[model samples]
Target: MPRGKYTNHKGRNRRFTNPEELEEQRRKDEQERRWRQQRGDESSESEEEEDEADKKKASGSKTRGDDDSGSGSEDSSESENSDEEKAKGVSNLIKIENPNRVQKKVKKLSTLNEDLVSQKPQLSRREREEIEKQRAQAHYQKLHAEGKTEQARADLARLAIIKQQREEAAKKRDLEKKQKEEALKAKTAQTQKALGKKT
Candidate 1:
């Protein structure tokens, strides 16, 4: 029944009893109060001051309106004169160009010199084909020397058999799909004819 204690039906106190724990709790509460103030939750004092200033300004404006009714035209004319004077002052002002502004010099880039660029040796079509043929012959000679020609041939045969089997399976699936579609179309035609006869 103490200030910060609670008891259930079992009658056990659910509050910290140690002095250190109470001190820690007080410190935590103080820290939270400071945080709330920083977050603008405790700014009622400043807000009250602002409200008072706003009320004063509103009352002053109402009193000024009652007194200024007779002088409204004069006030408007004075304002116009002030605006014209400001415009005249602006028009009489001289604009001085900055003496320290730098003038940029345009530079012309030099054209590329054909002689300075290194050129790759150009091969004619016949020469390119001959080079390719030589490379192929070299590669074949290397494979033959390594006794891999038979193994490569066997691999190619196996790949061909796999490709042929895949093609045959695809063809069989396509034929079966075509037959099913045709049967569906025939059934639809038969149903339409029977409906027409009944009508």
Candidate 2:
């Protein structure tokens, strides 16, 4: 009634022309907007609640208050200090007054020396054979006294061979023993370095 052409489309023109329809559409749009806004607010509030819970968990874990009385960090360090002090105390106790320990240490040291000596190389195979030959010769002499000349002659021959072998074997064993002594000397030197020659 007022002007030339309604620039809007036919449906839009119809809506604009009817006041009740326009009001109803506006009310629907406002309701949807409010629903969306409410959902956003609820999501943000939930996130804030989660953040607060996480902060509480982090603080609680750092303090370890549930497992220990509120001073967990302090107590652990104190315990470590106490353990070190106890170790020092034990060392001092051992150093200050323990004759029995000293005696035991000396006994152990002597035993170690004996072990080192015993580990030195022993008589050689030839030497052992020579000793066996000597025993056999003695047996053969006894047999000769009992009237066994053939066996005694054989034993005497073996005895001469054994004597020759014994000299060679003795020399070999002496050389091995000397080498063992040298090895022990080197080992002792290393041990002294490690122990710093404590009296």
Candidate 3:
């Protein structure tokens, strides 16, 4: 092995941690995790709900007080709208700021993302080859059905050769049968003529 500062050399063996120290570290990690989880629960939607209730109670009190001031009620309502808008902005920021919110997926708004979305997924070599073979087979089948493919032409040629061979064999059989019948008839006629001459 290539020796380096981090690599264990012949003179120095790898260091081992004590089991007690390992146990302590594990305990610390568990405690820290639980503490973080408790904080996350406290800072979650429950806090938002409480804030909303508080806002509503404050608005109800303001509306009651504004009734005596007449036009102040309308202005207060508008101010409340602005306040809610600002709160909405803060709410978005708060949601983003939450430590426990794990951003597993990043939204990429670009031409590359659109192109990637439109493109087919990556496939294994065998899968790609299988898909290609299927496509080729389907294309050939379609062309064969239309009698427009080379394979269809070759099949027709083979069938024609077979048909021609069959026709030739049939013709040869007919010729042989006709020849045999003619020979038999000639022999019988000659025999009859000889018998007549003798009688």
Candidate number with greatest TM-score = 3
Task: Report the Cα lDDT for residue 142, model 1.
Answer: 91
For candidate 3, what is the lDDT?
A: 0.63
In the order shown, what is each candidate's alpha-carbon RMSD? 35.0, 38.5, 20.6
Candidate 1 lDDT by residue in tens digits, 1-199: 5455675556465664774564465456445544655687756534543553464354332222222221357568746544554433334222234569988876544433443355567899999999999999999979966758987778778989999999999999999999999999888889989888532
Q: What lDDT does the true structure give each of the candidates?
A: 0.60, 0.61, 0.63
Give the per-residue lDDT of model 3 (tens digit) for 127-151: 9999999999999899998889998
Cα RMSD (Å) between model 3 and the true structure? 20.6
**TM-score of predicted model 2?**
0.22
Runs off by more than 4 Å, candidate 1: 1-148, 197-199
Query: Per-prediction TM-score, please?
Result: 0.25, 0.22, 0.34
Model 2 regions lying over 4 Å from their true place: 1-150, 194-199
Cα lDDT for residue 38, candidate 1: 69
Candidate 3 — which pairs collide?
A: none
Cα miss at 134, model 3 (Å)?
1.8
**lDDT score of model 1?**
0.60
Stretches of model 3 off by over 4 angstroms after superposition: 1-102, 105-125, 192-199
RMSD of 2: 38.5
Which scores better on lDDT, 1 or 2? Answer: 2
